[model samples]
Every structure is written in structure tokens, then in C-alpha cells.
Target: MNLFHFSEENGIEVFVPRVKENRKNMPPVVWAIDDVHAFTFYFPRDCPRIVYTRTNEMSDEDHEKFFGLTSSDIIVTVETDWYERIKRTTLYRYKMPSDTFQLFDACAGYYISPQTIIPQEVEPLTDLLNRLMLLNIEVRFTPNLHPLRNAILNSTINDFGMHRFANAKGN
Candidate 1:
């Protein structure tokens, strides 16, 4: 394991020179709020709508069929609450107008809120989820091991449990 980790780290270091050269000389637009929160680079708020990617389990075909873009379209530029301490990162994506979908400049959002944040944030999931590390509420992932232990009975919920477990895995 030590040898493997050492080789991996060495390989990453070897790539650092190329990575630095490839990096664009751009100013940092995103601003960090406290230690956990941050905001996007100051750009025209009225510009083209930004795209967001769908969930991991969502296939490329299904995402394009439903939302017209793969999961990579979404960009998460900020997070502002204690949830960061819990390793729960929140992401956001903006959607544009096109066939099948009617809304223009709509915000198609999602969040990785844990059980810890549910009791802390007061607003609805739609409103509170857009911003990260939302101090407005105390939240963390719920500890429900029963469903996880009995995962084989229901595959869909089991998948959800897996996702939730994945989010909390580091802790």
C-alpha cells in the first residue's frame, strides 16, 4: 500500500509541471465566505445561463433526453455553512431554454444536504439548497442504518442509502 500510494503521489507530482503550464492566467472570481462558503466570480448576472450535470446514476442518454446535458454542465462555485465541516458539498447548476423544456434561464438545482442540515436550515429545500454551507440551518446526513442493513430488499432505496453512505463515508 505504501509503495502504491507513493507511486500515485509521484505520478501526480510529475504532472504538476504540465498542469501549471495548461492553467489559464485568469483572475480568481469566486470569493470564499468565511471558511466554508464562497461566491462565483463577478460576471454579468444577465449573461447566458450556466448548465449543471444530473446525478451520477443518471446515464448520459437519459440526462440529455431529460435535461439536454450531461452531469458535467453544472458548476458549484460556493458553499457557506457548517455542513462543509461534515464534508457535505453543495452544488448548483443553471438551465437554459430549449425544445422539450419551456422555462427560460431557469435554475435546475440539487443539493447533498445531510440530516444535520435539515433541522438547521429553515427554508424549503429549493430555496436553501442553492447556497452552500447554509448557516441559516443546522444540518447533517441522517443516521439510518436499518435501511442500509436491509438494502437488498429494495434496490432503489438501497441505492439512495448507498449515496447517503458515500457522502458520509469520510466521517
Candidate 2:
């Protein structure tokens, strides 16, 4: 399905996998977050792909359609670009409130960093033991995340989480 991301500065940027060139190849469901409305994902495949516009720039019908979309609404069709812009090396998830973000970052770093900066470890009784073990092993095969340590202090992405953070190797 088409990935619809809306932002005041960028307007609306749509994205879909180029390989399949079909909505069926896209995720069965998507959670599109924007200030306009909250769509909890699972809309039909034939849902529209309109570029979200500013409150004033949007037409009355378009505004009604967007605002009418409820949290449980599901989207169906998808297409667009920006796969080249997402960070390939490190994946990130963000939640509200800056303090929680900082804490999550620190926890992730302490548990995954090779430097062993943090001496604390999750107890064997907890589920984190296995997850941490897997994560620790995963880190060995993954690129160093140190470069992104200070990333939040200096973001390279737009409000929609995009940008050409790096060039392709063989380009």
C-alpha cells in the first residue's frame, strides 16, 4: 500500500516498494501518523493516496476525508519514493516526551555498546536476559552504532523521518 506521510513543510510524500509495483506487496497494514488524524491502520487496498495539504491549502472535501478517517481505519493501495533516504545502518523508534526518548537511547546504548560503558546487567530471572543476549550477539554482526550516539543532538532527517543521509556504495 502507499505510504502517506504528511508534514506542513514537506506537504505529503508517498512511498511504496518499487520491486513489486503493487499494493499487495506492501505491508498488510500501516499506521500513518500525522497531525490531521490518527489512522490505526487496516484500511482497504483501494483507499485514496492524496497528498495531505495545509489546513488552508486543502479543499473542503479533502479536509473532510482526512479528518473523517478514524484511528481504526485501514489503508489499501501504496506507491512513492524515499527508500534511498532512510537510515540503512540503524533503525530507530520514537515516542512522545523527550525524557523517555533519552532513557530509551541510554538503555539501548548501555546494553548494546561493545565498549561496555555501563556495568549493570539484567537479572537472569527477567526476559531481558535472553533478549539482551540476542541483541549482544546481533551487535557483533552489525555496524558500530557509536556514530549515531549523538545523533538526536543533531538530526539529519526531516519531520517525517527522511533525507539522503549517505550515498549508495557503487553510485
Candidate 3:
């Protein structure tokens, strides 16, 4: 399986197995976090499909604290270019947050000196873990879509086939 690690400016890091092993019998399922409307795809393959009956009912203060931002403010910017990489890596990106956008620096990064720092904790456990479960499942040895599949939307793709098409189309 492939691994993906992302670090945010706020000392938050997210680690996930980009690709998970797919299995029979118990496939993956998509779960929605009602409060934030964030959806997570999970693989129930051989794992207990626990029924989280608890309501996603969070107080305004709790919700704001969880995300560290207001509802209308920029909580997290899911850039289009960032989704481009995810689409290539995960195949599907059209899941949550309909407000998708493209940014120029999505794939550009430079090291600041030679310093390394360890982080204390990461945010979005519920969001990341839920999405991870889905990513973990639906992974197969061959290129075949399985249950609970995902893809990115409104993102750039530079794959060989796509590149050929773009060259021909001249976009």
C-alpha cells in the first residue's frame, strides 16, 4: 500500500496509507460527519462495522474549537492542485466540499534551512481517519474500481494518457 503524509503550517500533520488492501465480503462504506458534512470512506473488510449512532450534534463553540475557525471563515483550503495529486494517487476526489478551487503553488515547496521539528498533535482525526478507512479498503492489486471508490474533481491531471490527450486537444 502507498503512504501519504501532509504537514500543515499549524504544526498539524496527517499520516495515512494512501492505498489500502481491498477484500471480499466486507467492503468499504462512506460515512458522513453531519456537523461539518465531511465524508469518510471506510473498509469494513474483516473489520467490525460499528454503528456510530451518536448524533453529529456539536455545539457551536465545540465545532468552532474543533476546526479552529468560524463557519464562514477559511477553515481549510482544499486547493485544486492539491486535489490533482490526490486524484492521481487515490483515483477519486469528488467526495466532500463542493467548494473546490485550484491554486498555483499546490505542487511547489522548498525547505527552510535544515531544521527539523516534531509536532505535538494533528487535527481532523475524525475527518482523516474516516477518509482513511475508506482509502484503506477498495485497494486492489489490479486497476479495478471496487466498492466505496473515490475520485477528485476539478483537478489537473498529468498522467501519460491524459498528457497525450491534452497535447492533441491543445488546451
Candidate 4:
């Protein structure tokens, strides 16, 4: 167990790096899972059509398949969101008459809601989860056994007829 946990008066739990592990550079990203099954799913709004990976990685096979680009092509600079979080974070689009998928530009003709994103100053997962309750989003994972889950299931702790248990290899 290399993690240390602390909670403020507001019940927001914070996880910082373990000093002994030499993990000082890890930028914090809040995460929560009531059970292992919990995860997030991204949805595309309105249109029945689904949009997949958008990238400017000219060298990548997937990107090359979708776009007629070669590895030797000159690449452009990339931009990212305020949260500073994105997977494989590289690639900003170049304005082209034939391109219809570069979503953030003026030609897309979409207006965003003022409340589309949560302010960065607010605590992350806790409040967003409360709001998600109204939408009935079910986040779950396959059940697994751990000390905390075991303690929850056997919460009584009466030990009326408790016997020592051993690991699978008969420890």
C-alpha cells in the first residue's frame, strides 16, 4: 500500500503521491469507483451517426486509413481543453474545405451551453456524480474481493465462531 489518503471537512478525499515511491511529478486527476465496475462512457449528442477517433498522427495506421495522409506530410500544432486532460494528446486540425469533422471551428455551426463543462476550481467527481444521478447513469464493474469489500460484507465483526483463514496456497 503506497497510497496515503486525507479528507477535508467537506468530505472531499485527496490522494497525493507516496514520497517513498519517487512519484513527485504525477499531476493529480481525481478518480472514484464505488466498485471496480465503475467507468465513464462518452456519448455523441443529437445525430444518429457516431464519430470515432480524430487525430493528426499522419504516421499512425488508423489516422492514415481515415485520412489520405503520408508519414512524410508536414504536421500542424495541437490544442487541448482547459482540463489539460486528453488521451494521446497531440494533433490540432488544419482548415480544409473538404474536412467536415473538425468540430470546434465556425463552420460546424454549433453553439455550446454555458454549463457544458464544470469549472476547474470545483471538486471533481463528487458533485458531478450527484448531478449524474438524475440522468440514471449506471457505472458498475465486475465484482471482486478485497479487504475493504470483505470488511463490508462481513461487517458485523462479532467473531462468534471465527476461524483463521489461509490464502489459496495454504499460507
Candidate 5:
């Protein structure tokens, strides 16, 4: 399986294990997302987004509410304010070896490795929205994400990831 670490900065030859300020209690490690969910990182680092997919456990009513009329299996939503920034952003996808990585959060496609990693290659990703469409992901832009976030929190759709939500409008 392919593992990747996405960043806005290029020329990153090595990824050293580092403790994230928000996750200080956890051990230092390099983080990577699996290929299946790499699309979650296809935006600016601080861009707030909500990604989710329908699961068998999700109620039909909840599915209709979030995905009604859409054929996409995956949905990614971002605040409208970040649309221009997302369109202007160019992300680097660093392909990393998975041998030393261990699954940290299966649902979130997060993997961690304590050892420093030298990426196999760095690929530049552009045309963000088109890329998501190519991946069969439905992208939604809303004035505010709070309503969707609250709805998901109360719904039966458990397969969801709200990234950098603290930076979202009105938090």
C-alpha cells in the first residue's frame, strides 16, 4: 500500500519524528496517510475540512440528509472562505515507505513511524478541485461548517474526519 505525507513546502528529503504541539502527550513520530484517504490532505495545511463516507451502519435517513442526489461515495466539505486559498494552493505529496509505519487510526487512515523516513518521491498536486472530482469525491463549499459538523456529530455516520476544525470560521 502507498503511504504519503502531504505538505505545501517542497524539497523535503527527510521527515524526522517530531511531537506535534497539539499532541504533546504522544511520542514523537512521523505521520502519513494511506493512499485510500490521501485526498483528505489535498488542501492547505490549515484549511478546515470535513470528510465522510457512507457506511452500512449509517441510517438511510442520515445518508439521504448528507448525500441525497449525489453519486459520490466520499464527501469533502470546506468553508467557502477557503475556496480561493484551496484553488491557489499546490501541495506536495511525499511517498513514504510503509515497512516501518504502524496504523494509528484505521478510520482516519493515519499511520505513524518513530523512525525518520526518506520519501521515495515527491509529487506536486495542482488543480485541487478537479483532482477531487477525478477521485470521485464530491466537494461541497458552505458559508460555515458548524452546522454540518454538528449534524454529523449527532448523526449515525461514524466514518468522518473533521481536520483543522479549530481554525474554522467562528470555531
Candidate 6:
């Protein structure tokens, strides 16, 4: 399986394990996302995003409520303010070997490695919005994500990821 690490900065020769501020209790580790879910990270590092997919577990009511009239199975929402930055940002996709990494969250396609890693290759990705569109991902711009975040939390949409929410507006 192909594993990747996305970053706004380039020239990353090695990845070292480090504890995240919010995940202090967990052991230090290098995080990577599998190819299947890599599209979710195609944005500025701190840009807040909420991604959800239509799953079998979703009820008819919830489906219509969240995805009414939309044919796309995956939806990615970001704050309107970040649109300009996203258009200008270029992300470096670092290909990492899978030998030292283990699945961290299957649903999120997240993997973790305790050992330091040197990327096999680094590819720069531009035209972020177009890239997401090419993947058939529906991108929504909102003034605030709290409402949708709250609604999803209270709904049956389990296949979702809310990232960097603290950076979201009105957080």
C-alpha cells in the first residue's frame, strides 16, 4: 500500500516522530495517510475542513438532509476565507515506505510510524481545487463550519473527518 505525508513546505528529507500538542498523551509518531484518503489533505496545512461521505449506515432522512440533490458521494467543506489561500498554496506530497508504518485509523486512512522515515519521493501538487474536482469531490465554502460540525456530530453521519477545527471561524 502506498503511504503519503502532505505538507505546504518542501525539502523535507526526513520525518521524525513527535507528539502533537493536542495528542500529548499519545506516543510520538510520524503520521501518514493512505492513498485512498489522501485527497482529503490537499489544502493549506492549517485550513480547517470537514469531510463526509455517503455511507450505507446513513439513514434516508440524514442523507437527504446532508446531501440532498447532490450526486457526489464525498463532500469537503472549508471556510470561505481560506479559498484564496487554497488557490495559491502548493502541497508537497511525500511518498513514504509502508514497511515501517502501521494502520492507525482504517476509516481515516491514517497510518503511524514510530521510526524516522526518509520520503521515497516528493511531488508538488498545484491547482488544489481542480485536483479535488478531478477526484469528484464536492467542495463547499461556508462562513462558519460550526453549524455543520454540530449537525454532523448529532447525526448518523459516521464517515466524516473534521480537521483543524480550532482554526475554524468562531471557534
The candidate scoring highest on TM-score is: 6
Q: What digit string (tens of lDDT, one per residue) describes model 6 on residues 1-171? A: 999999998999999999989899999999999999999999999999999999989989999999997999999999999999999999999999999999989999999999999999999999999999998899999999999999999999999999999999895
lDDT of 4 by residue, 3-96 (tens): 1111222332222222222234533332211111121211111101111223343335434443334332211111112112223222211111
- Model 2, TM vs. native: 0.16
Clashes of each: 24, 10, 10, 2, 0, 0
Q: Which 10 successive residues of model 3 have the least lDDT summed?
A: 158-167
| Residue lDDT tens for model 3, 79-120 | 122332333332211222212212212222111111222322
What's model 4's overall lDDT?
A: 0.23
Question: In angstroms, what RMSD does candidate 5 have relative to the true structure?
Answer: 0.9
lDDT score for candidate 3 against the true structure: 0.23
lDDT of 6: 0.96
Q: Model-by-model lDDT, in order?
A: 0.24, 0.23, 0.23, 0.23, 0.95, 0.96
Candidate that beats the other on TM-score, 4 or 5, i.e. the better one? 5
Estimate the lDDT of model 1. 0.24
In angstroms, the error of model 1 at 116 is 37
RMSD of each: 18.8, 20.4, 19.2, 22.4, 0.9, 0.8
At residue 10, what lDDT does model 3 achieve? 35
For all predicted structures, in order, the TM-scores are: 0.19, 0.16, 0.17, 0.15, 0.97, 0.98
Reference-based TM-score, model 1: 0.19
Candidate 5 lDDT over 51-90, as tens digits, reads 9997889899998998888989899999999999999999
